[model samples]
Target chain A: MSTTTLLLLLVLVGVLTYLYRYAMIGLFASRSLPAWLHALCRHIAPASFAALTASGLFVAGGEVVFAFDTPRPWAALAAVLVAWRTRNVLATIGAGMAALYLLKLLFPT
Target chain B: MVQIPTSAGGEFLAGCRDEAPLLLGVAPFGMIYGIAALAAGVPAWVAQLASAIVFAGAAQLVIVQMLAAGAGFIPIALTSGLLNLRHVLYSASMAEYVRHLPRRWRLLLAYVLTDEAYAVAVLRYQQRHAAAADHAEHTDSGTPAADATADLRHWYFLGAGFTLWAGWQLSTAAGLLFGATIPPEWELDFAVPLTFIALLTLLLRERAGQAAALVAGLGALAFAALPYKLGLVAAIVLGLAAGAWAVRRLGPVR
Candidate 1:
């Protein structure tokens, strides 16, 4: 991409994204939301976080990859288990990295 | 609700403190984006500025990937926009809390909003609401009034958002300067998902939450083929529906 194109791309995406973030915030400030929207909002964290986590673990380069040779799945499993059991962020990340290294050593691929 | 002892400055400090640990994951994630942007042949200056210009990790990465693939500008822009559409949901969710603030404050906060910041800030808000509810119950009022802390909560939001912003800029610069020296073996990028997992775990205190998460995860896989990354959006919708259904099936939580 040329510098002009790149700059334009950056500006366009940036402005569009800002609009999306600001739409509800700026427009709905004075209006009261319906009960159903509030209910959906309550679950936004769980649903979005879960989707992000799963896609991060399973999808690669726009394709789903779940191979035994890859350590990500196993490492993520360990992280989830650690997270569930301890609810400690550092512990969860530590367990994930440790499991990834261990699996990499065992699988060597 | 109650006479909670917290000022704007105190809440600001609290926000900074809460977001501090997540910066560990954020710094490396920013570095990864910087390195990836350079590797994709994005000019170093553009790459650095993109951190602020685009100000989104996933979307920036997507833009660079498409650039490297020689995709057209329109396609790249569209994909990035679609990928970031999730922020709409976040805006709506946060509308109630910060709505009463001035337009300038709302604009500023919206500009800095990101997935990490939203997760941390929302969790704080929810916890405070829960505590206020508990206090009301103990007093036998059975009525949780409007949040009294709303006045200073934006300070907390600002504190968290600005901290993340600074971390992202520095990390992106570091990656542009020295990221190549970092080896792929380190796998620092995995920290991003691990952080998400940690946040997900905290959000899953009930069966309805678990159902939402499960459906969202599975739905993302099923819809992975959707163009412009709309699959994530669809998955989230399905997840929320599943959660709402589960809530009705199980009845309300007292």
Candidate 2:
């Protein structure tokens, strides 16, 4: 792609993406959401983060790899335990990364 | 323990401080993005600019991938848009918290919004809400003092957004300039998922929350093959439905 083309794509997608990010916030700013929508909103964080976490741990190259050879799932398990127990973001990330490196060392694949 | 700030400056600083830990994952991911964008033949400047302008990490990465494959303009735009559709949900969830702000502030926040920033900001907002609820429980009349302090929470959101933005720009540049310094063996990208897992755990205190997360996580895996990242959207929708159903079945928790 030419520089001009790349620049154009950047601006085009940037605007489009911004619209998505701004849509609900901008349009619904004045009006209060109905009760059901409010209830749905409460679950957004959990649902979005959970799906993101699962895909990040399990999916590789567009495929959902369920094999045990990779250290991600175990690392994620460690992170989950730390998060559940400590509720500390720093500790949870530390535990997960430590678990990953250790498992990689112990079981190189 | 760090105190939650009541004033705007304090809240902003608190936002930056709270977000600092996540940078361990984010910085590496940004560098990886820069390196990948370079590898995909994105001009160094354009890659850096895209980091600033698009600001959506996964979608930016997808755009680079599509560019490498010689995809045309419309396809790239549409795919990026589709992948970012999830932001609409984030925007909706956040609308109530940020609605009281001025239009300029709302626009500014919307621009800097990303999954990482949203996660951190939403957590802070929820903490404030929880604290307020607890205060109301104890006091005969709700404290206007607490309400007044909470209104400045957007400053905290701005602080977190700015930190993530600055880190992303610097990391992208670093990746382009010193791509070889970071080893692929370290698998720095894995930290991103770990960050998400940590966040997911924090959000799963209630049974309904847990049910939503479980269904959504499983649903994402099940729908992983869907094109244009629709699987993520589908999983989130399913997860929300699951959460609502659990609430209905179990009755609302006090």
Candidate 3:
């Protein structure tokens, strides 16, 4: 994309994103959400996060490969374990990154 | 009558203080975005502008990749918006505490609303509400409304937002300038997935969240071959469906 096009796209994306976030809060202000809707909202973060994380972790070159040789799945497991145990975001990220680099060195895949 | 906090500035500063650790966690991702935007051939000014304009790490990264691949503008913009739609839900959740603020303040707050800020703000609000409830039972009706506490929470959110916004802009600019110097073999790309993993781990602190994450992961894996990022769409739908189902079946936890 040309610079102008990229700039336009960036601005459009920014406005749309800000509106998506802002509109709901603006519209729903001072109104209590129904219990069911509130309950559904609780899932939004986890679900979206999971979708984003999983797509990055397992998909490679438009295919799914679940193999021990790939560092992602294993490193993710390590990260999850550390996170669950310590409930620490930084530690979990560090452990996962460390595992990936170590696996890369040992296996070279 | 409610007594507003005497030190909105101080409260905002303290909120920033609480968010310092999360800011650190987010900075590397911002730096990675900067580097990746440059690698994707976005112009230095455009790349930095994307950070300034979009101010969202994940959506900006997705937009950069799509633009590099020659995706149409409308599709790229829509996808970016869709990816960030979850923020709407966050806003809805956080609206209750900030609803009483003036319209101008609410509008500005909405602009700066983000995942980290929402998380910290809601937690603080809940804490304040609980304290108020505890005090209400023993106190007489003459006590003032607890607006000061709410003001403090709002200030905290401002600190968090300001810190995040500054870090994001500076890092993107740095990446645009210094990105080409870094070798490809450094595998900085891996950091993106690692960051998400860390975020997911932090999120799955409860059974419903854990279940939703598992469903999303498995769904994404199952539909990984879908074209045009359809797998991602499927993963989101399935994950949310799974989470909603879990809540329906088991009810809210705590």
- Predicted model with the maximum DockQ: 3
Candidate 2 residue-wise lDDT, B18-62, digit = tens: 888877878766776777676667778889999988998767766
Model 2 docking category: acceptable
Best first by TM-score, ranked: 3, 1, 2
Off by over 4 Å in 1: A1-13, A20-25, A59-65, B1-29, B32-47, B54-106, B113-164, B224-233, B252-254
Across A1-107, the per-residue lDDT of candidate 2 in tens digits comes to 78998899899888888987887789666565466765675677788777767776676656888767678788888888898899876688789889999999999
lDDT of 2 at B105: 90
Q: For residues B1-254, write the lDDT of model 3, one tens digit per residue.
A: 22324477876776676667777767777777877777677777777777877888878776655544445666566556666776777777777677766678777788778877777777767776776777778765323234443445667667777876777777777766667788866666555566666667677767877788789778877887766566666776677788878876887788
Relative to the true structure, how large is the alpha-carbon lDDT of every model?
0.77, 0.78, 0.71
How does model 3 score by TM-score? Answer: 0.76
lDDT of 1 at A53: 76
DockQ of structure 2: 0.44
Which portions of model 3 show Cα errors greater than 4 Å?
A1-9, A34-36, A67-73, B1-22, B39-41, B61-83, B93-97, B119-160, B175-178
Reference contact recovery of candidate 2: 0.77
Cα distance off (Å), candidate 3, residue B91: 3.1
Best by TM-score: 3
